[model samples]
Target: MGSQSSSFSLRIWRAARDMVVAWGRIGYLGAVVGVLLLSPSTYRGHALRPILRRMYRDTAPILLGFTLLAALICLVITRIVVVTALSYGLSRYALEMVIRVLVLELIPLTAALFVAMRCTIPNATELALMRQSGEWAAREQRGEALIRAEVLPRVVAGLYASVTLAALSCVVALVTAYLGVYGFTWAGLPGYTRMFGQVFNPSVTLLFVLKTWLFGLAVAIIPVSTGLYARPTHHDIRPGGELSGLARMFAVLLLIELTSLMGNYY
Candidate 1:
């Protein structure tokens, strides 16, 4: 019993340590964003335009497909919730509540879940396969851009996909909220913007941005690292190793959402 508890504690500690390192890397990305932008001598558009363009080039179809699917799912869910609330004679506040719960909570969670389903496992699996096949070792020994090719691009691309999709999804949810509550009316604009302002205060926005970035990082890093941690014989990898990484990824994402929610409301 004591050994089991000790082992569990160690796993928890390792997961925490990995999250710390990931956040540290994200902070470094933020710092580099300035250098990346300053060289163009033009702030008319984001200096990160080309990066985003590259991201769109690589993942636009997948991103759009994800967005459409999420919109459809959330639309149904929101309709059910709103219709049920109306049946309870709470229609007046249904819009507010939906925006809060669906827009602020479910949509983001859905986005993360979608990314996990789409990217995390495959990235982790591929990295594990590569590690098993000695690709990492070959690149390392050959003095090649292992970090650039294997790590950074995946990291950047995943972040771009997550962030873009989350932002777009939130916008979609907001618009859906308006149409759900006050169908086809411009007068709803004021109320919509006001409630949006309430929900999307600067602090909330910061948390949203930070959370999306974390989601992106989690979706990218945990699996790759876990893949790297696998035994030399890829097919011989202990099932538990991949499961452990996925468990940590979900845990970190939940912790982040909890912390951000508390930050905004508490």
Candidate 2:
């Protein structure tokens, strides 16, 4: 029994140590990418092309479909909120609730997850495979800054995708909410604008923007970092690397969401 207890404690210690190490690596990679992103030299000539191509690849293909999906979701949820508020004699607060819930929260989170599934996860898996096959090391040995050439572009693309989708979806949600609440008319524009302004006061607007950027950063950084640092395994790389990256990204996203909630509400 004592031996078993000691073994279990050892396992727990190793797990905790590994978690800390993983997060440390992620932080270090993020800082490096952030510096690269800010450095003008990294954007010169050849590098700029890849970043632009990645941004277009990540954003263009799915924009219309994502916006339409967001609008449909916003419409359904707006109707539900409007109906519920009417039933409860709280119609005045319905628009604010819709804006708070859909625009500020749901749309951004949904956009991040969508981009992760569509682009980043697959990118990460490819990077992990490259890492495992020694391609990254070979490039490094050849005096190439693989982080700038390879990682930075993907990170930029992820950030662009998340922010673009969220911004567009928020617009769609607002329009849907207005139409749902006030029908197809212009009479409610002034009142709707007033409430929109109230819910998105300066502080809340800052928080919302910050939250969305953090979401983008998580969507950008976690998977790529995971892939860049993943260890080789005998089994297929996809399941392990992609699953771990997704889990880490989700955790960071959840933390950002919770912090935003606290800032906005408390």
Candidate 3:
């Protein structure tokens, strides 16, 4: 019994270690992804071009859908708040508030949740099914290919989608905020830029980029990788198998966001 207990403890430790390694490799994947996305195909010639082509193909529709939905939501919410404030004779402060809350906080968060809802679950389900069928291991000779190919793409894509949408949404919200507050005129544009520069300081901009990148990685990778953890070297499901992954996913996402927010604000 004592030896059995010792074996169980060792298994737990190894599982924990595997999770850490999984996430660490994910970090490396993220760096590669960032380079691929940022640099041009011309730099590396044809090698990365295929990746870029495939990435753009996968990304365009997702980005468009996300942008449309996000714009509609931000527009509706912005209009409602602006009208409410104008009704109360506080139109002057409405734009700033809307830009701050909607652009800074709600839009990014909404994009993350939206992508998680649309993308993450399907990724996990597909990976889980692949693991069940043993096709993943057969494909790359290394079981980790499921992660490199299937999971990592979505993780990287989610990061792109989140940051792209957030940055784009900021532009849209600011434009709408400008039109809503100051009438469409040359005079308003300069003041708008000034106000934007004030609100969007260096730290805030850096934090926004960092936070969204972290958010994107956490939301996408957590679900899929946690799903990976449930499967043993052998095929059959273990105890606490299914729900453990999902629970861990949400818990980690929440923790990451909370820590990012705390670190940024404090």
Candidate 4:
């Protein structure tokens, strides 16, 4: 019993240590972003263009599919909100309810998670392979151009995909909400705009912007940082390292979502 208890305590300590290391790597996003800002000069060399193009190709389909899914979800939720509000004789609040629920909260988070699943995991794997193969070391020896020509493109591409998906999904949800509430007409535009104004007051608007930006940053940042933590000489790269990074990334995402909810509702 004492040995079992000691083993359990050791496990807890290791888990805590890993969590601290993951949080420390979150600072890497700042450095990556700073490098990304200076990366445009590398565009003149044309080396980064293919990478950007490939990232776009990979991301566009995912964005389109996820946008369609978000639209379907928005339609279903809008219908339910409209029906429930009408059943309660509170039909007047249906649009506001959809805007607050779908637009402000769900869409951005959904987009972030979609992009993280689609983009971040593969990018993490690629980075891990590069690190393990000594390619990252070779690049470091070459110069900062490796970051500009290689790493920053992937980082920026992920950020772009996250932001684009969220913005598009939010627009789709708004349109679906409008059509669900009052089909095939602009007559309700005035009231809808008024409700939008009221629900998205300055504070709420700021929060939405901040939350979406954080979502994009999280999707772009976490996996790559964790993947880069791989030991260059480590051979067994299968189960433990990859899963640990993904788990930590999603945990950070959940934390961001909870923080947003608390800030807005609590």
Candidate 5:
């Protein structure tokens, strides 16, 4: 019993330690982003150019698919909100409810998770495999700029993808909300504009923009950081490679989402 207890405690300690170290690495990645952002030369040459093209090819189809999904979801939710508002005799507030719930909250979170699952996980897995194969050791020995030349583009691409998806979906949701509420007529445009202005006041608008930016950053940074920090040793490769990074990424995403929820609602 004593030995079993000791083993369990040891495992807990190691897990905690790993999480701390992973977060420390993510902080370093943040710093790298800052430095790269300030350095004009980081965007020069063919290094980042090709990456942009490649990322577009990789992410465009998935983003298009998600936009359609967002449209369908927005339509369904808008119908429900409008119907419920009418049932409660709050029909005038239907558009407000749609903008507040669907546009301000759900779309951005869904887009971030979608990009993280579709793009970041695979990127992290490839990076881990490279790490396991000793691809980075030689570069490190040569003092190559791993963060600037290689990883920076991936991070930038992921962030761009997140923003694109969120913005596109939000637009789609707004249009769907209008049509769902007012149909294919411009007769209700003035009322719709008034409700839009009401729901998206100064504070709420600021919070919405801030929340979307944070979601993009989280989706971009967490997986790459996890991949970079994963152990390259054979014994740890199979178990710890993708699973640990994914688990950590999801936790951080949830934290960002919950904090945004509290800030917007409370």
Candidate 6:
């Protein structure tokens, strides 16, 4: 029994240590990428091609599908909110509620999750496979900085995809909210715009943009960092690296969302 207890304690310690190391690696990689992004030299010549290609690959294919889905969701949600408000005789605040709930919160979170599912997770898996199969090593032998040639582009592409999807979805939500609140008419445009301005004052607008960017950054960074540092040599530890990365990514996203809520409401 004592031996079993000691063994269990050892497992707990190792798990805690691994968690700390994983987060440390993520932070270090994020800082390195940020520095590279700010440097003008990082975008010269051969590097530019990969970034543009990645941006196109990540964004273009999914753009139409995602936008359609966003519009549908916005329409459904707006209808529900409007009907509920009217039922309660609180129709005056329905648009404000929709704008606050749908645009400020739900759309951005949905976009990040969508991009993570479609792009970043797959990218991370590919990176992990390359790392396991020694492709990264082979590239390093040829004097290529894998971080610059590979990781940076994927990170940038992920950020771009998340932001673009969220922005487009917010637009859809806003339009849908307007139409749902006022029907197919231009008469409510001024009042709608005024309500929008009130909900999205300068501070709230800044918080909204910052929150979206942070969501994009988290989506872009966490999985790739995990993939780049994955230890696939041990048979016992190899199988669930991607799963663990996904969990970590989700946790970070939740944390960012909670912080944004506090900033906006508290």
**Model 2: how far residue 203 lies from native, Å:** 0.3
Q: Which residues of candidate 1, in runs, are more than 4 Å off?
A: 1-58, 234-241
Supply candidate 6's per-residue lDDT for 196: 88
TM-scores for the candidates: 0.75, 0.96, 0.70, 0.85, 0.91, 0.95
Q: What is the lDDT of residue 135 in candidate 4?
A: 84
TM-score of 4: 0.85
**75-114, model 6: which lDDT tens digit per residue?**
8988998899999999998889989999999999999999
CA deviation > 4 Å runs, candidate 6: 233-241
Cα error, residue 4 of model 6, in Å, equals 1.5
Would you list the rank order by lDDT, best first?
A: 6, 2, 5, 4, 1, 3
Model 5 lDDT at residue 143: 97
Looking at candidate 1, what is the lDDT of residue 93? 72
Q: Candidate 4 — what's its lDDT?
A: 0.79
- Give me the overall lDDT of model 5: 0.82
TM-score of 3: 0.70
Residue pairs in clash, model 5: none
lDDT of 4 by residue, 144-188 (tens): 465555556667777888888999999999899999888999999
lDDT of 5 by residue, 177-261 (tens): 9999889999999988888888788988888888888888888888878776677675655322367676776787788778877
lDDT of 3 by residue, 124-231 (tens): 666666666777678768534344356546656656666676778767767766765665777778766777787678887777777677767766666655554445
Worst 10 residues of 4 by lDDT: 232-241
lDDT of 4 at 167: 90
Candidate 2 lDDT by residue in tens digits, 35-114: 88789987788879988998999899999999999999999999999899999999988889999999988999999999
Cα RMSD to native, each candidate?
5.5, 1.4, 5.4, 3.0, 2.2, 1.8
Report the C-alpha lDDT of model 1 over 1-266, residue by residue, as the tens digit. Answer: 99999999999999889767755654564454434335454233543444455456546767778778877866777788789988999876777788778767777767766765666556556666776677878888989745444544454656666777788898887777677667888998987788778777888788877877777776656655565455675356533246666777788789988987898778
Alpha-carbon deviation at 89 in model 4, angstroms: 1.9
